[model samples]
Target chain A: MKKEMVCISCPMGCHLTVEGEGDNWTVTGNSCKNGERYGIQEMTDPRRILPTTVVIKGAMISRLPVKTAQEIPKGKLFDAMDELSKVVVEAPVKVGDVVLKNVCDTGIDVIATKTMPAV
Target chain B: MYDIIVIGGGPAGLAAAVEAKKEGVDNILILERDRELGGILNQCIHNGFGLHTFKEQLTGPEYAGRYIDMAMDLKIPYKLNTMVLDMERKDDDTKVVHAINEEDGYMALEAKAVILTMGCRERTAGAIGIPGFRPAGVFTAGTAQRFINMEGYMTGKEVVILGSGDIGLIMARRMTLEGAHVKCVCEIMPYSNGLTRNIVQCLDDFNIPLKLSHTITFIHGKDRVEAVDVTQVDENLKPIPGTTETIPCDTLLLSVGLIPENEISRGAGVEIDRRTQGPSISELCETNLPGVFAAGNVVHVHDLVDFVSQEAALAGKGAARYVKGHLEEDINFTTVNGDGIGNVVPEKITVANLDDSVNCYMRVRKVSTDTVINCYIGDEKIATKKARKFVPAEMVNFKIKKSDLEKYHDGELKFVVEPKEA
Candidate 1:
């Protein structure tokens, strides 16, 4: 079977084509070796980190904005957002303050992109 | 006599005029030197703009069209083919603008305030220090873009593009689509200066090679360009030995960079920032001259046209305030560029009683990962935001809320970007 993946390791999204038998594979169309690993992973499990603003109270605005510090597993994004939806961070919170620690044990933290001041 | 006179008919001018009008400055006129409206957008035929402000995909012309349509609907007065030569502020309320029209060779126009939105000019081969005999085949990326997109002229069959900026990258795909074979895009920097999307859609999708940390050492051509010698560079951007490779091509397209057009700003005795090459304004976009305002590419090179529109609107509104005798002359706070940041616009923060939020437009010196940009009012950190990827090509924008400005009453406000913990 042949599999293709767009490598996002760099700006050059090399379209890597791979022919594999089970776990073993041969890859082509990749300008670099990083694309090979990306193509193989796409065949196994694909994931993306979701960065969306979550509401926060105790600030000037009714809701403060937050985002995932890094991409979590693609399958766990929904559960992550669900966990983030219930969480509200306090103001005067610095950037990189973990809003939700170990969200669903996916080992990702939803962090604040901007600092908010407390009243 | 109008309240405000906006120079240039580009997206920046059109948006600025519309914004000024929206702010209740009725008597406004947009002066465009071109035969028609829609400045640079008239020549650009690619579809990679307006993702930020509009939330939809649009080409350059399409984005400019939206603004043009809005300006027309607002009944904003505009004069086509009118080139402004110089401007001087007579007093706090009066400004003399010297301009020339196609029919009328020269004339002096009076206005209450002025908005400079002349946009920018492309960096040519001579500016980049490309050693070669002056030839006809070498052209700036914008020039080539106009030639191909507007005039329907194929630049060349075989082309080597210098500088991996967005214009060069887009032109690579454009030339290829027009049946021209592009050899490669060479850059002195290790990373791509253009947006990640452009690198993907323009170069990667088209199978064009982007050579990083490399530059064109010399050009080989007699009457026209025949080939170029490209060499890899060391850490200091000095060319490394034994890494020279000559690529044979008939034409060399320079997508090097763009410089803000501020020639008129200098003529008016306005203090220009060496870095931005534009007039140094305060939070109000008011230059050192009292009634003169500057915005858009005349202020700095913006990645997105939407940001240009947004900034120009502020300048337009600010100009209208100056015209209506509601502007304050005393600026309390100053804007300073902090560590890791290249430059920040609106050199000072005016409007003692800060109401609306202020937007600081800047660029980083180098590529950084997982960085947090902090805006400080003296010692107090007013705003801080994290970024995934930071590149010099990408302009970093930081918005300061009115509340944030109120926290620091008076001091030099510094904006800095520092690396964050991974």
Candidate 2:
């Protein structure tokens, strides 16, 4: 199998051509090792770190920005978004505070990116 | 009098204030119109920031938090919810900042040096003059970003984003995550103005079609945006007849362009650059007014936050040097934008300001392959940068070494992009 993709690891944006399967993959047209790894990742279990906001009560702002603790499967993005949208965190929340654990059964926790103090 | 007065508490302002404090400038003040110190970063929750500065891909809020922490660690005093009304350069060479806030009604503060980091504002539908009703669902891309990322509100369900700017690309993904069907992103230009990474991750990842060289000719609906007439354009960006396609969408987001918020800079008698619509500055980020410096989007729009932080640091150092009586007052040369170049920041350059190297940030006017950028100083080639391809979306930083100058010609320093013949 051959897969053509662009590496989003950096702004260099190397176009990668991934061929073969599993550990026997051959990635070409990559400028760096990150692109090679990204090609392999894409061919394998493609994952992405989802960053979104959830409801925050009594905070200076209405929403609190949070991101997945680990990269979740790309297919599970909207599932994670669906799971995260249901969450309502409170103010006085510190950065790195876990907003939701095991989101979408992906075993990745959603943590706060900003420190919100109660208004 | 304060040693340095940093305007706006965003990444640029925070970085400037922190760097000035590190430069041993004791009396420093930061005035932010927003209630929070992070400014736009507070609402920009997406990752891909701080790669150059922190060497890690961090979210916008996280990136801003690092600088905010740095400012707090240095005990830099900042006033929130304070709007700068005007700035005046007194005869004694000091600056009086007129500002108003709930805490400090209308007050005038004196400072030896001022750094302008008021940032930029998004161009709205009205600015673009799209043929449409002053509708309800039509929002600027940045405004929609704020609504979804900070206010916890979605702008619309079925959306058609006009202008494939980075903000619009970002919004296409943000809106998609919240269960909105992003129909497509339309760009009148032959290419997308947004970065390659954004086009790939935001639009491509979601399988959203990007119709290039196409523009919305007419918007339908009275109270809100309903459908827009999308039409393909010629090489000159003029819409072609018999090529109109109407896409039904509840929301129409315009990601046209950004204008620098520099009313106060003009009040201070700082010269403005027509192309950038921002304050023109020296290599030290100092404006024509000796003690006044400008950086970040207030000088010219930047593609990355790390560059903004880096540029602001230069302005901070410039302010510190000005306050310490070390900064040069003599303007050596004005930078000229030659063929194929869009805009260049630090429109002026001073001999004394050049250290190891000076960074000149710019964007190309259009797409070209095998591009060679030549930097000239009074008929002398000072620097050259070769890139496989240069696009308008990415900013090119051309560094001119102090050693390259050898002797100051005291004339125009120009940058011209030379494209390889096909």
List pairs with backbone clashes in candidate 1: A49-A71, A56-A64
Per-residue C-alpha lDDT of model 1 across residues B154-258, encoded as one tens digit per residue:
789999998988899878877875568998999899998787757765677567899999999988988988889999999999999999999999889999899
Leading candidate by TM-score: 2
Query: Which 10 successive residues of model 2 chain B have the least lDDT summed?
Result: B402-411
How would you encode candidate 2's per-residue C-alpha lDDT over B1-422 as one tens digit per residue?
89889999999999999888888898999999998998888888988888788877789899989999999999999999999999999999989999999977999999999999999999988788888677789899999999888887888999999999889998999999999999999999989999887899999889999999999999999998889999999999999999999999999998998889999998778999999999888887988888898989989888898999999999999999989988887777788899889888878777777778888888888888887888987677788888777999899999888776647757888999985545
Residue B141 displacement in candidate 2 (angstroms) = 0.7
Q: List the residue pairs that clash in candidate 2.
A: none
DockQ of 2: 0.82
Candidate 1, residue B236: CA error in Å?
1.2
List runs of model 1 lying over 4 Å from the truth: A1-119, B91-93, B351-354
Best by DockQ: 2
Chain A TM-score, each candidate = 0.77, 0.92
Q: Return the lDDT, model 1, position A21.
A: 75
Write down the TM-score of every candidate: 0.78, 0.97
